[model samples]
Target: MPQLSVIVYGPNTQGHLTELLDSLDAHPLADAEVIVAAVGDWARETAGSHSPETIVVPLPDGTGDAAARAAGAARASGRWLHFVHAKDGLPAGAPRLIVERTAELDAMDTPGALAGPGAPDAPGAPVDVLLFDHVSTTWQTTAAPSGDGRLLAAVGRAGLPLDRSASLLRTAPLLGNRALRAAFWRAHEEEFTTDDEPYAACAALLRAGRVACLNQVAHEKRVLRPESLPPLAPEDRLALIDRYESLLALTEDRRAARTVLYDLMVRDLVRTFARENLPDPVAREFFHRASLAAVRWRPEGHQRPAGLEGVRHSLLEEGAYTRYRAFQAANRTRRAARKALRSRKRQVSVKVRDHQYRRALSRPVDPHLAVFTAYWDRGVACNPAAIAAKLAELAPHIRRVWVVSKENAALLPPGTDHVIPGTRRYWETLAGAKYLTNNVNFPGAVVKRPDTIHLQTHHGTPLKRMGLDQMDHPAAAQGLDFAALLARIDRWDYSVSANSHSTRMWERAYPARYTSLDHGYPRNDVFYTATAADVRAARARLGIAPGRTAVLYAPTHRDYEAGFTPRLDLAALADRLGENTVLLVRAHYFYGGAASPLTGLRRSGRIIDVSSYDPVEELCLAADALVTDYSSIMFDYANLDRPIVVYADDWETYRTTRGVYFDLMAEHPGKVAHSQEELTEIFLTGAWRDESAAKARAAFRRRFCEYDDGRAAERVVRRVFLGEPEEALPPVLPPEERTPAPTPEEATA
Candidate 1:
C-alpha cells in the first residue's frame, strides 16, 4: 500500500482545481496515491486531462461534497488519508513532509518498539490524527498563516491525545489541515456522513486515541468573499444544531473536550446569527435552538468569555432575541454616526461632489450606455480603444462614451463622444452606464452598481509581479494601498487575458471571483491584420528611411529610480550601430510629456523619439526589430515573428526589486545582452537574425502569442458587449498558423 492517499473533492465548475493538481505534481512524493472524487462528468474529464495517473471516482451530478469524500476514502488503499478541496492547494514540499512524518509514526508503532519503557499499551498505538498548520487567503488580503502556532508548538513533535490539546478546537475549524490514519478513519467513518466538515473534525478529534501536531503550513485555503458565497438554505442553517448535539455527545465524558466543544458551538452560532442574512422566521428559530443547546450543554462551572462576548452568552442563555436585536441596532447607529463624522472632515467641495455622485447613482442604469477609459483617462487607447472600435461596428445600438483628461480630449477623434474627468457629465455617465470598461482602474470613489458590468481589459501580459504579489517587493509597492487596489479589483465582472500563462498569473496575483476571458488582447489585432502597405505607411509616418533597419528600443521604468533616467546611452549605442540602422526610442509611458534626454541625438538623425506618439500599435508595425529589457512590449512584439534582443544591464537589481514572474534571462525570445558592447556585437555578427535567433523567437511566440489571430476584438466584442455565449464566440487561431504584417523593406520589395 502507498504511504498516503490524497483525496481531492469539489464541484465540476471549480476554477482552481488545475492549480491544485499542478502543485501536487510539482512536489512529487514517493509512494503517494492521488484520488480525485469528481462530482460530475465535466469534473472527471478535467481531472483526467490534467492528471491521468490520478484514480478518479466519478460521483453523479448533484452529489454532496460529503458523499464524494466518503466515496474517495472508501477507495483509498493507503495507511493514511488526507482530504483536499479543489479550490485549496498544497504548499511546496508539503506532500513529502507529510509522508515522512507518517513513516516515522509507522516505525514507532512496529511490534518490537512497543516494549520500550514509555511505549503505549499495544503495537497499534500510532497517532490517529495528525494536525498541521495552514494559510488562509482572501480576495483582498495576502495569504496569512492560520491556526494558533503557540498551541501547535506546545504539542511539539511528540504525539498527544486530543484531551491534552483540546484548546486547539478554538483554532481554525477546517478538515484540510488534518490527516487521519486510514484504519482510524474507517472505525469512525459514519461520523463524517454529514456535510458539516467542522462538526466532523470535532467528532474525530474527540474520539481519536492519539493526536499529533505538525507545525509546517501544508495547505492553502482560499476564503471566498462573504458576498460572493452562495447563501445556505434555512434547513442547512438549522442542521447545525443537530451536528453540534452529536459533537456534544462525543465530548460528554471529557471535561476539557466538553468545554472546548461547547464554547466552539456557541461561537459558531453567534457568528452566524450576527453575520448571515437569514429570514425572520428562520432567525428566530435558529436563536431558540441555539439557546436550548447553550443551556443544556453548558459545562459545570464553565465561565463565559469576557466583555461583549460574555454579555452575548448571558443573552443567549436568557433566550432574549428582542434584546439582541435592539443591541445590534444601537451599535449600528453609533457606527453610522461615526462614519458621517469622518465623511464631514473632507473638503466642502469634495463632499458636494460625492453627494451629487451618490444622487446620480440612485437613478436607474441605462442599458444602452457604455463608458470606456484607458491609461487613467489619457484617451481611448489599448484594449479599450480596440473594443470600442469593434463595438461601433457590431454594437452601435449600445451608445459609447470615452472618459478623457482635459489635455487628451483634443487627441480624441473628431466625432468621438467624450467627457473630461471631474465634470458632472463624467460622474453621471459613470453612474448610469450599464457597461464600464477600462485598461486601468477607475477612481476609488466610483461605486459599483448591481446592474453595471465592469470589464477589465488589461493592456499587456504581465512579466513583473502584480497585485498582492508586490507586497514583498517594497520598491515596486511604494506607497501602494493594497486595500484600495483590491476594492477596485472587486468591481470587475470579467478580466481579459491574452494566453493561458497570463490567465494563470492573473489568478495568482489577483485572487478575485471575476470570470477570466482567455481571449487575445484586442490591441494586438493590428499585428496580424495590417497589410504590407499599412506597414509601409506606418514606417513613413514615423519618418523611417525605406531601406534602413529600424530597431525599436523600449525599456520599462524602474520603481527604485525617482525620475525617468535612461538606462542606456542612446547616443553611444546609436553611433556604434551602422548608418544602415536607426533607433526608434520610446520611453516608458510614465514619462509621457517629459522632455527627451536624447534630443541632441535626434538632430544627428540616428535617434527618433516617439514617446508622445499615439497608438503604440503603429510603432510596433513600423519597427523591423525590438530591443527591450523587462518590458511587456517584448511579449507583444513576439507576435510579429521578428528578432528581439533583451538589453538587460541591471537585470539582477530589477528582478530582485520588481519580482519578475519568470526569469527573462533564461527564457528570452532572442539574444540577451548584458552590456552595450554585447548588444553591438550581436548586431555586427548578424546573430540577431540568425537561425538560432529565429528558433528562439518561434518558441517565445508559441508561448506568449497564443491568442492573437487578427480577430481578438471580435471575440471580446461578441462576448461582453453583444452578450454572446462562449460557444458562439470566435475561436482562437494557433500561433503557427498566424502571419504577421510584412516589414517596410518587404513591403517595398
Candidate 2:
C-alpha cells in the first residue's frame, strides 16, 4: 500500500487542485497516491493532469463535503492519509516532510511510537498517534507519552484542539475498525463531522496513549471550505445534541469536557445564528434554549467570542430575546407598510403625469440642445460634462441648456444656461430641443420627438451584463420592463460606444436602428492630451501627499443589495496600506446619491472621499493605482497606463446573480483578488501592478480603448453637430501637441 494518500475536495475549475498535484509531483513521496472527490465530470480533466496513479471519484452533485471526504478516505490505498481543501495546497517540501514524520512515528526506535494499531491496549503497543502540520513550523502539540498509565486522562485534561490541518494518522485505526468508518458517516449524517471524527478516532487511540506529536507542521489550510457550522435545521440541532451525548459518555471527565464543548459550540452557534438569519421559530427557540442550557449547566463560567457580547448579554438578560425579536418583527412590518404606501404613490404620480409628459412635447421642439447625465433627478457629472464642453466650444451658435436637478441647480457652470428638471422651462426645453444627449438612458417620462436626435453616451465598457442583455438577471432586472426600455433605446438617434467590444454589445443588445459612433468614452479623452502640468494640477486639487501612491478603490453597486453597503473596511484598509497610500474612494452615483463613503472616519490623512470631485478623469490622472470590483471603470482606467487590482471578494455571487460577459477571474485586466488579505498583500508589495497585472493591462487597452484618442469629443462634435462625414474630421494632433503629463518630481513638488 502507498505510504501517503492525498484527498482533495471541491471542483478544480480554478486549477487549485492541479497546483497541489504539481507541488506533490515536484516533491515526490514514493508510492504516494491522490484521491480527488469532485461533483462534476470536470474533475476527470483535472485528474488527467495529475500523476498517473491519481484516482478520481465522481461525488454526487450537491453532496456535502463531509460525505465526499468519507468517500475519498474509503478509496485511499495508503498507510497514512492527507486531506487537502481545494484552495490550499501542500507546500513543495510538505510531501517530503510528512513522509519523514510518518516514518518517524512508526519507527521502533521512537519512545512510545505506534507499534501499529493492533490491540493498542497490549504492552508496548502504540500509545498515541503523532500530530504534525504542513509548514516547517508546528503548533504546541503533545510529546510522546511513554508508559504513562494516565495518558487517556492527561490527553483530555490537556484540552488540546485538533486544528483543521492536513494531519497524518495510522490507517490501521481507520481500516481495522469497521465501527469507526460507520461512526464517520454517522457523525456527518448528524452534522457533527470534523469535530466528531477526529475526537472519536483520536480518543479511542489515546486511551492507550496512542496520541503523539512529531513536533512539526504537516499541512496548510486556506479559506477554501464553506462554513461547516450546523444550519438552522432540526436535524442539525439534533446532530449537535447527539454528538454531545456521545462525547459525554466517552470523556473521562464529563463536566470538564462538557464545559469546553459547550463554550466552543455556543461560539459557533452564535455566529451561525446571526449570520444564517434563521427564520424558523422552532429552530430559533431551540437555539435560545441551548444558550440557556449552556448558562444553566455549564461546568465553568460562560465564554463567548468577540462581537457576540450582545448575544451573551441577551441570553443572560431576562426576556431580551423575546423583546428583540418582537421589535425586529414590528420594524419589518413598518418597512413593508411604508413600501406599499410608496408604491401606491408612485403609481398615482405616474398616472397623473402620463398626459403632461406627452403634452410637454406640444411646445415647439427647440432646435438647439439640452443634455443631462444619467437621470433628470440626479445631480452628477461624468461623460456629459466633457460632451457639453466640446459642444459649447464647437457649436456655440447652437442654443445649449444644461439639465440639472433642483438640488444641483447651483452646480451649473457660470454663463451656462441651465434648467432645473421638472420645471415648466425644463418641459419647454425638452419639447424645443432638436438635440438631447446623456451618458445614460433619458428619464422614462421624457417623450421622444421625431426630429430631435437623442445620443446615448453609455458609461463604461461593460464586464457585467447590462441593457437588454441583463433581461434575464433577476436582481438587475427587478421591476424592469424590457419592452419599454428597448423603446427608449430605439429612440436614440446615435449611441456612443467606448470600444469595439462595447459597440458589438450595444448593437446585439439594443438591435435598434441607431448610429453607433464607437468613438471611445469622452471622459477618458483627457488621458491622451493631459500634460504634466495638467496631471500636477489635478493632483494638487485632490490634495495628494508627496511620495504617496493614490489607490482609488471604486466598486460597482450591487443591484440586489440596498443602500450603500460599505464593502471595504476603510480603517482596516488604511492601516493595512500604511500612511504612504492615500485611498481615493469614488462611489457610484446610485450609492447614497453621491454621498462619500468615508463619512465617519477620524478624517485621517489616509482616506479621501473624492465622490464629489469634479470629473473623475482628474482622479485617474492623479492616482498611481486603482482597485475595483466588477466596475467597468477599469476599462477606462486602463487607458491611463496605471496598475489596477480587482478585489472581487463576492465574484461568485456577483457573477451568478448579476452575471458577467467574461470570466474576469481568468482574464481581468488586473489580478482578481478573492479576499482582503490577498488584496492588501498585492497593494503593500506593489504586486497589484507592474509585475502582476501588466500584461493583462496591455491586452485590455487594445481591446477596450482602441478609439479613445484625446479627440473623441471633437469627433462627436464634428460628426453629430457640424454634420461632417466620418472621413471629413480633422487629423488627430501629434502626441507633443497634447499636453505631457507632469514628471514625478514635478508632481511630488
Candidate 3:
C-alpha cells in the first residue's frame, strides 16, 4: 500500500524535486514510504537523489496528470494514498494528524470515510470538510493544494482544505470500485488539463468517498513559478464561469459558491481587457465569446444569469445615460466656442518635400494595365517593402501603379506616385487613382470611376466579428459611417488576398470582391525565402544566443490610446523550458516609445526586447516559435511553417470595445495556448512537428498560399502584365501530388 504519491508534471525546475522530498520527509509520519511518479527524467533523478527509499515511477512522455495518478495508484501498496506534485509540499503536522483522525473515526459510533470537525458555529459539531467563510478577507486558494489532497465541494458543501488534521480513509468503498474508477478516468482524462471544467466534473462525480478538511492551516502553498501556463484566454473565462455555474447547481454551501463566483467575475474582467487589445480576427472572436460569457450570456442557449439583471439596471443603463449627457454637454460647449475658435483652421494635406511624386507621375501610364494600391488605415499589412519590390519588378514594362493611403505617404512603397490624403481628402484621393483597393471597410463611399479597375486586397483573414457576419456591435451609425462608404465602393474592385482559413470566410464576407488570390503582403516574400542561416546571423547581430529557440511575442497596440498593461509571465516561462528558449518582445508600431513595465526580464538572458526591428522581417525569420494574441503577421508566418501559438487570454472586453471580424477559436490554423504551461509544453516537445500538424500546415497552404514558390512577385507581374488571369496563377497541387522540396543534391540531379 502506498502511503504517499507525488505526481510531478513537466517542465519542472531543477530544485523542484528536492523541495517535494524535503517536505514529505519532515512530515510527522516520515516512516511512510514515498512513491514518485515523474514525467521527465530530470525530475525523477532529482527525487531519487533526495531519498533513495522513494519509489520512482517514470510517467510516459505525453500522459496527463490524471492518467499518471491512476498508473501510480495501481502500483501502490500503501494503506493510505496521498497525491502531490514535485513543486508542492506536505503540511507541517499532516502525518501525525492523519493517524489521529483515523483512530478517532474508527472509535466513533458511525465510521464514515470522513470523520473530523466541520463548519464552525453550526447547529452540530464542525462538519468534515471545512468550507471557506463567505466574509473571509484572505486570498482564498480555489484549487486544492497538491499535498494531502482531498475531494472538496464535489462530495459536500464544505470545500475540503487539507491542513494538519486533514485525512481520508482510503477504504475499498472510498477508493471507488477499481473498474469504475479506471473507466471513468479514461473517458474524461483528456478534458482535465483543458480547464477547470474537468476538475469540477471530478468533484461532482464524488469518485472519492466523503472527504474532510482540517480548519488549521496545514500546508503553506508556494508561489506559482512563472511560465507555468499561458495566460487565460477569453474563451477560458466563459468555460470557467460555466463550470462554476454547474458546480453551484450541485453544492448547497452558499459560502463556497460565492468564493468561486468571485474568482470567476474577477477573471472575466481581466479577460475583457485582453480581447480589446488583440489585433487578429481569431483573437477578436475569442474576445466576443468571452464578453458574452462575462455577463453569463449564452448566445445559443438563450440563457442569461440572474446577476445580469442588476448589471442591466446599474451599469449598462447608467453608462448610456451618462454618455448621452456628456455628449449633450460637449455639443453645447462646442456651439458656444465655435465662433471664438474660428481662427483655428482645419488640418490641410501635407505638402511633399521632394520631386519623387513628379518623377513617378512622369513615368507614364499605359492603358493595357493599371495598378492601384489603396489603404484605409495603418498600412502595415500592405507590406510596403514587398509592394515596392513588386512595383520595381514591373517598372520597366507595366504602365502604372498608383498608390493611395488614408494618411498621406503612409508607408507608400518607394517609387510609387500619389499619396492619398487623410479622411478630409478621401474623396479626392479616390478620384485620383485609376484603380481602387481597400481592406475590411473604407471610411465612406466614393462615386464609381470610369475605366477604373477595383482590386480589394483585404488586410487579413482574421476570425473575429467584421463585415457581414458581425454578431454584436453598436449600431452602424456610430463608427466611420458605414452606410455612405458601402454605397460608394467601386464594384469593379473584384479581387482580395485570402490568407489561410480565409477562403471560406472571405467568400461569405465579401462575395463580390472574392478573387482568392495566393498573394499576401508581397514583402513577406523576403521571409518566405529567408534561410535558417539568416536567422542565426540575425541572432548573432542582436547578441542573443544562437542555440536558444526564439519565442517572438508581438501584441498589437490599441488605437484609442487605451493602455493595455499586459502581464507576461517571462520568469516563469524561462524556468519551465530551461534556459534554451529566448523571448523576443515586440509591441505594435503604434506602441512607438511606450516602455513595457514587465522589467527585470532582460536580466535572465532568457527574455529580450527586439521591437526595434524596424521592418519586423528579421524578427519573424529568427523566431523558432511565434506566440501572439492578435497581430496580422500570423498570416505571413504561414509561409515559415514554424510552430505558432495564439494567446487570446482575453476575448470578451476586446469585442465589446474594439470589435472582431471573425471567430478565432473556430477558424485559427494553429494550437491555442491560453496558459503558459501549455505553451512551454509545445516549445519543449516540438509537438507542432507532429504528423497531424504537418497535415494541418499543408491544408493551410492549400487554403491561402498554394502558389508560394518564392515567385509571388513574378507571378503577380506575369498575370497583370502578360494578360493572364486564373491560368497565369499556378494551379494549387492536390495533396497527393505535393512533394517536399528537394535538397541541393537532389535538386542538382
In lDDT terms, which candidate is top? 1
* After superposition, candidate 3 runs with Cα above 4 Å error: 1-385, 397-430, 436-447, 471-480, 488-492, 499-501, 511-524, 540-542, 555-561, 588-601, 630-632, 648-670, 684-704, 730-749
Q: Return the candidate ranking by TM-score, descending.
A: 1, 2, 3
Which pairs of residues clash in candidate 1, taking residues 3 or more apart in a chain or in different chains? Answer: none
Least lDDT summed over 10 consecutive residues: which range in candidate 3? 129-138
After superposition, candidate 1 runs with Cα above 4 Å error: 1-346
For each predicted model, how many residue pairs clash, with residues at least 3 apart or on different chains? 0, 24, 43
lDDT of 3 by residue, 1-749 (tens): 32333333332443555765765554324435566776676766666676666677777566665555656655655444444545544433343334334334324413223322232222332223221101001122211222222232223324233221122211111111111122223333444333242442333233222334332222333346345645755345345445544543433333443344434443444334333444455444543443444444222322333653333323322334344335546656887798556534331122331133333344433344344443344443353335435655665543453445544465545655554444323434444445454444444434454555555555545545445444245432235444444453436444435354565666664445435556544555665466546666666776677456677888764333322233345555666678777788886665443433333236467778776565576777767667877676776666666666777655555555457665656555577665555666766777755665666655555655544445555555455434477675755444345333322222223
Candidates sorted on lDDT, descending = 1, 2, 3
Error of 3 at 459 (Å): 2.4
For each candidate, what is the lDDT? 0.82, 0.62, 0.47
- Candidate number with the higher TM-score (1 or 2): 1
TM-scores, all candidates, are 0.54, 0.53, 0.45
**lDDT at 352, model 2:** 57
Task: Encode model 1's per-residue lDDT on 208-295: one tens digit a residue.
Answer: 7667877656677877776777876775788888888888887756788789889889998888888888889999999999999999
Model 2 regions lying over 4 Å from their true place: 1-364, 593-597, 730-746
| Lowest lDDT block of 10, candidate 2 | 136-145
